[model samples]
Target: MDYLLAILIIVYVALMILVGYIAWKHTSNSEDYLVAGRQSNSYIMALSYGATFISTAAIVGFGGLAGTNGLGILWLVFLNIAVGIFIAFVIFGKPTRKMGQYLNALTFPEFLSKRFNSKFIQYFSGLLIFLTMPIYAASVLIGAARFVETTINIDFNLAILILAIIIGFYVIFGGIKGVMYTDALQGTIMFLGMLILLISIYSMLGGVTHAHELLSSMAPLFPESAKVTGATGWTTFPTTGSPFWWNLVSSIILGVGIGAIAQPQLAVRFMTVKSNKELNRAVLVGGIFIFVTTFTAYVVGALSNVYFYQTTGQIAIQAAGGNVDKIIPTFINSAMPKWFTYIFLLTLLSAAMSTISTQFHVQGSSIAHDVYCAIKNRSSLRITRIGILIAIIIAVVLAYILPGNIVATGTSIFFGICAVAFLPVYLCALFWKRTTKLGAIAGIVSGTVSSLFCLLFTYKKVAAGLGICKFLTGKAVLFSGMPWPYVDPMVIALPIAFIFTIGVSLLTKNSKEEEIAIEKMFKAEEGA
Candidate 1:
């Protein structure tokens, strides 16, 4: 079985390398490297976007979470379609594509900088992406690494190191073209793998109704520790008003859902296409892709609990020895046929690599193209490739050091920060001609600082698990006594940033020239 799995993986890796080589051959300039020369078709763009957005975090981290949390986590699946695919592509996609082309903006920060006519916005936003994005990138690395380590029985550190090197090589060599081309392939693999896994699980558990019935019947079997944190069962929502409920709704669901709009990596996809027509055509493909991938994972993951309990007399979480991160992979290893296990492992690998490649590409562009090239007034493809290498090293180290629940933790933190810092500014840049430089700057600064402070000092995970704040505060979380222990920072920081952005914009004014630039940006806006 191991030998057969290795053969399958080797074939997949060869295919990925071939794709990277093809992309590298065609990538002759910075434009091709950054945005695929803005010529990708709707199919390639949509699949790449879906693949990049739905990463190992969704399949491994969130899937494992669903094993314990129940189908309620499907809210994220719904939101991924509604907000992430529909609103993002249909509503924001057209304006973003138009303005990005108008401003000659290849990167998200560059878009903001040119739209607002502020180098400060460009440099600062680029710096933020460079500095803070690695944590999220690391989370993705960890998710894939864990699966590889468990499925192949390899060392965790070794698995992460190998995975990082392979992903970094292609990303550094092929750039966005490589990332997107490979993303389309990876997305296809993930769709097939998840669909199969879902079907097999339902069949194993005697179909959806029987599986869910068994799961709902085990509500009384909820672990004592979980119960204390307000876990009612795998079949129901977290206990309302409990710490777990706040963590689920506010931190996990809302954070990632809202944050999807402002993701630097995902935003760059709009600039990769030629027109809104591609985006419009992409909506259905992207939506179906996201739906199949996430809906299947969450349902199958939740149903895994029923499968495990019946087969092993142990709940999924308990069977994995209390680490939810291990539940999904372990369940597959234990419950599935050998051939299917090998195939599912490919899906896991594709999920991690697609997302990780995008992160590396985005980080590379932010540092090299957005920051260095903008300042130097020259673009160096060599420097961008080098930046990708550096980012991989940093992310690999972080992935090695981070502990359990790293996927969800990293996703929430990055998403929360991005939402707070970029969402208001991004929306205003697209729709509001009155968004002054000062307002944009103020909103970004306040949002970044507030979110970071809360994440480090007020969130229990960082305070305790990371120990960054324990030295000063002598407690895991400074706000441990607050109404909700794990409420995501977006709850507080997003509103503050939005209010400041609106208030500051209303009080201040844009120059006539700047106002004209803003108006020209939206002249082709479909929804505006």
Candidate 2:
């Protein structure tokens, strides 16, 4: 079994390397490296987009949450399909693509900086991304590394190092083209692997109806701490207005759902394709892809409770030693066929690599292409490669040290920060002509500061454990005023940022050149 699994992994990795080599040979310029020369097809773009967005966070982090919280996680699935894929593509994709071409924008920070003609916007945004994105990237690394360690029975730190180096090799050499090519292949694996796992879980439990029925009947086993947080059961939504509900609705769902709009990696994909039409076509495929992968993972995660209860006389969380993040991996190891366990490990690897590669690429672009290049007034491909390596090293170290359940914590931090810091400015830059450079700067500063403050003073995770917060406050959280232990900054910072942007913009005036650029952006044709 070990030999067979090793063979499968070697073959899969070899394919990835071959694809990277091909992409490296074709990467003759920065454009090809950054945006795949803006010539990707709808299929490749769609799969790549979905794969990058739905990483181990979806499969492992949120899947574990479903094991504890129940079917209510489906609300996130609905939001992903509706807002993430459909609205993102139809409402934001076209204008972004057209304007990206109009302004010669390559990265998200570059797009904003060029849009409003603000060097501060460009530099600050790039610096923020470079600084904060490692948390999210590290989370993805931790998720995949956890599975790799458990499945291969190796030292956890060594597993993380191995995974990071492999990912960095391809991303540093292949650029965006290699990343997307691998993403397409990885996305297919994730979709198929998830489908099979879901089917097998249901078959083991009789069927979907029986499986859910059994799960629903186990509500009495719900945890007491979960009860205080408003958890009704694994089969129902937490009590509205309860701490759990707030954590679920405010932190997880709203943080991630609305946050998707501002994700630097995903947003960059809009500039990768040739036309808005390609983005439009991608919506359908992406929607289906997200649904299949996320839905199956959530459903199977919750149902795994029944399987564990029947087999081990314990629930999913208990069987996995009380770590929610370990629930899915444990189930795969103990409950599934040996052959399928190897397959699912690849799927998890696919999820991790697809997402991490994008993170590394975007981080590299943030520092090298956007910050350094803009300041130096030249694009050095070598600098970007070096940036990629630096980003990988930082993320790998963080992955080794991050707390348990790093997936959820890391994902929430980055998503919440992006929603608060970037979404308002990005949205206004794309749609609101009156959005001045000052307004954008004000929004960015207020958003980032407000979110970080709230995270340090209000959220328990960062407030209590983050040494800086504890040193300054002498407590986990400075203020105990929050109704819940966990409330994402988006609930507060996002609104503040949005209102501040509008108010500041209304009070300020755009320069003549800025006005002309905004007008040109609004009226520009594709490839103009």
Candidate 3:
């Protein structure tokens, strides 16, 4: 790591702090803090949305995932654009914006609680967000710091703390305006860095034709373990019933695709826009952003393996650090020019920071605005700042103690949990006419408990790694289980929650209060 390069990176961090300082002026209330006063234009909205959604999980996890999974991982980029961005803006964005406006709800929990009529739903959902988001945030911290420490040679713990403090305080002070403004800027860095990396790699490998030909000839670059796992070659395409295929099709694509529609962090962007037309405008920009950035990232992640194989005849299996997580950084250090590697480090740091800030922000307000404020009737910036502080502390602790693939696993668990606990009650609040409060409560409990139980007792890595699952389930249930498969727990739990909600609702007659709530939703929606 050159001194000049390290200085350059540190300067960028300072500039980000300055941006957050600027955002402090814009936020005066809960609305401003949470959703930028609901006035972000399409460009800001789209870029910010894209940056936040493309977290360290996408770069660190997905890039390494590509090394092992091969071209098959390309499926994720398509899903991100189509389901994560495009349809998210079209289908989910519109309704979320309309209802958020009608209910004056700033957080997802607030939206669901206001839409339905349950305090338990609001507080419990907030608890879930607060609990899981830190694990995700810690993962983001770990990813950003790992790259910085390796590329620049900073201590691991020091880098993690510095990054966390900067992001935490910036978000705590600047709120949504700061988050979006910086995200848009970071999105540009990510795009340009990837562009440079791809062009350089292909050019170095003797152009596209030579590179592809060399890569294709080495079909055995992929190990036999991949085939048993149900994958073709990483350089080639996917095969049938492979874990890779099931993971791509069933878990990654379908799980995240359907799940993105319900993501609170992204959904808030719809509320931030000034009008439906702005959201409509955002789809084009968002589509282009996703296409370019994600396209470049997936391309780089997949093809880096090709580059490695052709150059060293050694597979991507931890030649440098012995961990898959280091694959991209190792590639940058070895394959890319020093200047570009520096920029790529910034690119990754920015991506990780952008998403971590949002996660922390969302987690804080879920506690402050949705759970605490709804009960306590407090919404001061000071109270929100305290909430942010508490959330950051928890996340920071997690960052130090244990973190690997934390963001990815946390995402699977978080999204799965949200899908189960929030999805059924949320949709009912918006569209269903006959949903009862009893049903909503039943759904929340069943979904949350079921998902936790599955993640604990059934997911082998999660259970064995934590050891608490072993204690609760004892040896038999722990050792005998098939382990949570490719499908996130949401796959099973969501349906059960919906069933529990609907079955109970159908059995019970709607109270006049429930009728009035439905009528109000329709009336407000029609007028809007």
Each model's C-alpha lDDT?
0.87, 0.88, 0.76
- Candidate 2 lDDT: 0.88
Total clashing pairs for each candidate: 0, 4, 1
lDDT of 1 by residue, 231-325 (tens): 99887888888888888888878999889999999999999997778999999999999999998878877887787887889988888887878
Per-residue alpha-carbon lDDT of candidate 2 for residues 281-347, written as tens digits (9 for 90 to 100)? 8998999999999998899789888889899989888998988889999999999988999999999
Q: What's the ranking of the predictions by TM-score, best on top?
A: 2, 1, 3
**TM-score for each candidate, following the candidate numbering:** 0.97, 0.98, 0.93
Looking at model 1, residue 264 earns an lDDT score of 94
Which ranges in model 3 have alpha carbons more than 4 Å from their true place? 1-3, 206-213, 235-239, 242-248, 403-407, 472-486
Per-residue CA lDDT of candidate 3, range 1-528, in tens? 678786986798888988999889877787888889989888889989988888766777667667666666677677788887777888778778888988888888888777767788789888888887777678778777778777888998998888888898789899888899889888888777767777887788788787667656666656776676667776666666555565666555566656766677777788898888988998988887777766666566666767676678676664545566677777788888788878888889888988888888888888888777889876777877788888888888888987555545665566667778877776776677788878888888898898787677654546667777667756523445232344456777889989998988888766787788778877887677
Higher-scoring candidate on TM-score, 1 or 3: 1
